[model samples]
Target: MTPLAIAEHAPLFIVLNPASGRGEADNARRSIESACAQAGREHHIYQVDRHRRLQPCVQEAVERAKAVQGVVVAAGGDGTINAVAQATLGSGCAFGVLPQGTFNYFSRTHGIPTDTDEAMRVLLNEQPRAVQVGQVNDRVFLVNASLGLYAQLLEDREAYKAQFGRRRWVALWSALLTALRGHRPWYLHLSWHGVQRDIRTKTLFVANNALQLHQVGLPEADAPEQGQLAAIALKPLSTLSMLGLLVSGARGRLGEADSVVSFPFESMTVRPMRGHRRVKVATDGEIGWCAMPLEFRVSPEPLWLVRPAVAPELEATRQ
Candidate 1:
């Protein structure tokens, strides 16, 4: 049951997302191949094209990998990892991450190496660890699931990035500003762990574990643990106050924002009071716009991950 024990018995299945991070899959594949050659380890690589194709690919990979230790390595961004995790959940297949993406939030959280060579080394040398994953409506996400203005911003950023190359921060900032100006509060009805609460919020974030935004202070103790979900709702604020809160959040001092409300829950539902445009949703870094109401929940069991050794140490500390 321990990480060390799991590492000794798992085989590696490297799944690469060819479209991730401006087409870095070829380079990553080379690195992985080189690493496997050097390490003299048995492995297989599966490159995924369309997003919808990930589920079937992962499912088949899981079945194939089950014979050789049941480990699946996601070689793209968080989106690739999320897709693979959804397939491997409860299948006894451990997941690994290569972190070739823009944000690489999951890698940062788990302390995976950023350097390609170093990441490959870690992949060959690391142990299989048990980490928590969030499940919403039978969907699995390893990092966090969120809604509100930020999700809308992600939508804009993704579109802009496709057309404008890598330097698209300006477009993202502009989209964020636009979202702030047009943002409106919506009523959220949530019930969890035998408690019920209502709130009007402009943004809702549900993380699988505490998230430290930009190295700012981490979430509070109320942050959901593995197999639990932590919910944070940003109450509507004046444009000025919201800007201030945004600045504070950027500085990782979100506790200073009076408009922020946070709690831990197992399940919850969010709905708009009146029919409006569909709400945007994001799990990890993938974005989609969905109509209200949205249902979110946590899986009963923890997902297995083949993470760097530092992941357990990082998880032990509350930042």
Candidate 2:
């Protein structure tokens, strides 16, 4: 398929979350409209409201975009991107992002500029490229997924974001508070690489984004680029020990921590050994419950992302 360009005739179906962009949905909408108009691109904007309308909105956009061979764009944070990506998967519609969140990991990693105007321009001028995706059960995650303490930390972070604000410092502070509080270990049975073991852990995190892993100092940061998922498990720890582990992660030396178990794999099965049939899981910062045992793996198909062409040097390294 030809790449979408500024002079292209295909339409763009934009899914915008009003809660994102620091509640400046109007600004995002205007920027999108202005860009599309200047480019003479046909486009449709679907606003995702607070009534939990993201799924239906995205589905509608996906169907429309698919019919016209247009792009389905996500103009929000990670949660919004995940929602749109989930619907666009297998729809044969290229996905675009207009990063409007505290952390734009997916957009930044893929070279989708966080600036709304710049992102819109890229959407109009880029081709769809297949990118790695991680899955937990049936849900697709573009960044990471986890349960146990990490999952709890996500929930706590959201609460903190609501009370304090939605900023990086706020998120970091919330994580510190969550980690400083003692957490109960999760007794889980893990099966991976033809091996099965039972372990007590504070968290079991599976990463699909190499940039995030590298930022957190995990040695298996290259797992995603190698077509595999990276798993990080935290052993049960004292409060101070947990604090130390957090520091290690912040310092990009998490793999060097004794309490950390890091590995790369194509698949892993985790079951609650404590008779719990359901567990809270966080995917791309969204908290939800999934039935045990949880299955984490790389998706068989990639998410067709709309971004700038990869540099020849980077492409060579990937090959």
Candidate 3:
């Protein structure tokens, strides 16, 4: 597909998450406004706070962008990006991002600058490129989705962030605490592309971001680029063993760990062998519950993401 014709005066509808990063939310808002004003671009900023929820704001932005043939931009963390992507994916409206998050796996993977000023420049000048996405049931996740112990870890990390503030150390500490506390292994029935197996695991993590997979030292890190999703399952382990596995992940050797099982798949279904109808799931760092059996697959259509232009050689390779 050709890139959208983003004229200089093209409207930009942005959905901003107030509580996304450690920086003041107002700062991001001002930065966005200042940039657009300097560029002479028409823009709309929708703030999502306690009173103004995310979904409605995203819906409004998507509708407005669709109406004017403008770009719908997500200006926050992965969760905020996921929400906006859910509304814009396959809607024929271009998607853009400003990385106001700690990890920023999605934006960084696509070469969107983390600096607000640089990101605004890219948003204004870049073209739309088709990007892969993952879906668990009806929910879209740009970075990852997981259940069992990994979901619990995300929940605990949020609690810690709420208390100690949002910092990398706080997230790491929460993971350590959660892992040390130990968790029950889930006996699950998993089927993927016609193969079925029963397994016991502490977590089932599905990754759609190559940057994140590569950071964790998974062999399937290139899966997303290859039009596939990577699944990582952790075998039952003692608390000490689990900590050891975490260390290996930190050192980027997770795929070499004995307790880890990693592979790439197009689609998968997971059901609890214990007859539970609901399970806690984490998608792009947001925690929620989903009724089993959970169906995870790569979305059939790619998301039209507005990002920096790829180099000629790399673009040809992607083709």
Candidate 4:
């Protein structure tokens, strides 16, 4: 079917990941249902299997939502949101979210309420609008995607969270401790904006969402949706140097570290200079190995993200 008119009212189909927010997402279901009911919304909620693949379930839910103008709501962490968002791409389905995850980075970034009841009320009252998203190969990440140190940091953070529980600050602290053990740099060949460059850096962040940058306390990276993305690459550094970078970043002085550099671009291709055919990549808090010569670009078709009526900077980002 052709894409529906941009303002069509649709029934909400929420795909929730029960394991997100350390089972807090599951606990929030009653509140979600109650809010939906009180708001007089026709909504269906699904809890996908946590142990198995989520994309298929997400696809099926979005498919079933076609009758009501194909609106799907992702009700978990960034990973779950990413899956549903990717599936929504090109399907003409408007997507919404309830920030039931630890960080709720996407939710907070878009001015959606973090409280489930408030979020549902907002969802019930709003219509989806187009917004830009980043694509790396076949995957669409609602937040930033990265390789090298950031990927390892996500891996270590998840490990720590699985062991110590799913507190956002704790995950950050644990990742810091893991980074204290040191990191290795990868030589990369990056081609973007008609330039080819070489760099040995511990992490390369392709940021398209401002809140993710805010989470890292970078003022320069707070708005990546101006038709370009911010790419930051850090040169190899010792553990102490990394710590200094972190501390300086917390004080809004990331430029004080000489090993760091960043620029904005619409698209770029990155490949490890080392002869590896694939590398570990992290997207929206999900970690996995992706093939070499990765292509990262902002998708041409803007996703119709249904934001609350009072979304922060909605006017600014929709530009």
Compare the candidates by TM-score and give the number of the best one.
3
Task: Report the poorest 10 consecutive residues by lDDT, candidate 4.
Answer: 1-10
| lDDT of candidate 1 over 166-280, digit per residue (tens) | 3437554756565568677677777677777778887787776454532434455334443457777888888878777767766778865667887666777776666755766
**Per-candidate RMSD vs. true structure?**
3.3, 3.0, 2.8, 3.1
Shift of residue 252 alpha carbon in model 1, Å? 1.2
Model 3 per-residue lDDT tens digits across residues 47-107 = 9988999999999999988888899999998889998999999888889999888788899
Clashes of each: 1, 1, 0, 0
Give one digit per residue, the lDDT tens place, for model 4 in 1-319: 2333433345678898887775776557898888767766677878877454577779778898765575788988888888888888878778888877787878887888878888876677776767779988777877889988888888888888888888879787987887787677789999998999999888898888875565455545645657777888888888788888888777656755677888778889997788979888888989877888899998888877887545574344434
RMSD of 4: 3.1
- Candidate 4's C-alpha lDDT? 0.78
The lDDT leader among the candidates is 3
lDDT of 2 by residue, 1-319 (tens): 3333322667889989978637778888999999989988889998987664888899899999888788888989899999999998877778889999988888877777777998888888887788889999998899999998889998999898888878889999999999898888889999999988888988998998877777777778888888999988888899888888878877878889988888899999998888889988999989988999899988888888888875332343334
Screening candidate 4 with a backbone cut-off below 3 angstroms (N, C-alpha, C), the clashing residue pairs are: none
Model 1 segments beyond 4 Å from truth? 1-10, 50-53, 166-175, 209-227, 271-280, 288-295, 312-319
lDDT value for model 3:
0.88
Ranking by TM-score: 3, 2, 4, 1
